[model samples]
Target: MSDWAYSDVVPWWPYVFILLGGWLPTDVWRYIGVVSASRIDETGEAATIARTIATSLVAAVIAQLVFYPSGALADIPTWVRVVALCIGFAAYQLSRRKILAGIFAAEIVIGIWALAPGLG
Candidate 1:
């Protein structure tokens, strides 16, 4: 059984691992959060701290992706990424901090950069 789990004899083994190892663990937490959400106080200090931490983590991830990217993103020049970030931030600010607007603006810039010849 262990050998079969590691071998390619079962093509769907990896999918089973993904469902068990990845999805199930996260889904448990999501279900718990959903069940307990009504008990959370939105205006409480704990909530405020959670929000701050979440925002900081997101910002850190963005910074890491832009400054030290891997894989396909690494192929794009740093200047292009910075320009896209700037445009996206400006769009977000101008659109009253709409996240989709910022994301769309950044995507448009990156798409253009990828498509245009001699731009990268």
Candidate 2:
């Protein structure tokens, strides 16, 4: 156990345990949400609140990426990130609020910016 702990690489067992530890709580909540939502009308207050909370969480994550990124994202210029986000939001609005389209647009724009001569 000491040797495993000292090594740079984590053993397979720890990864398995880590995966389960990370996934179980989220999966349990997801299961509960699915079961609970089955009985809730889509037009009900509860459903609206759930949707609002989910949207707020996504927005918070996007805001965090823009304001407090780590690793490679931290290295990107703020203007580039803001531009990418604006393009993404525009794409989302133009694409009838398709989230994937928006995300892809942002990623593509940033990727092109990074690949541009003298950038990144």
Query: How accurate locally is residue 92 in candidate 1, as Cα lDDT from 0 to 100?
Result: 100
Question: lDDT tens digits, residues 52-86, model 1?
Answer: 99999999999999999999999999999999999
lDDT of 2 by residue, 21-102 (tens): 9988889999998888779899999889989999999989989999889898998999899999999999999999999999
In model 2, pairs of residues that clash are none
- The most accurate candidate by TM-score is 1
Global CA lDDT of candidate 2, please? 0.89
Model 2 — TM-score against the truth? 0.72
lDDT of each: 0.95, 0.89
Give me the overall lDDT of model 1.
Answer: 0.95
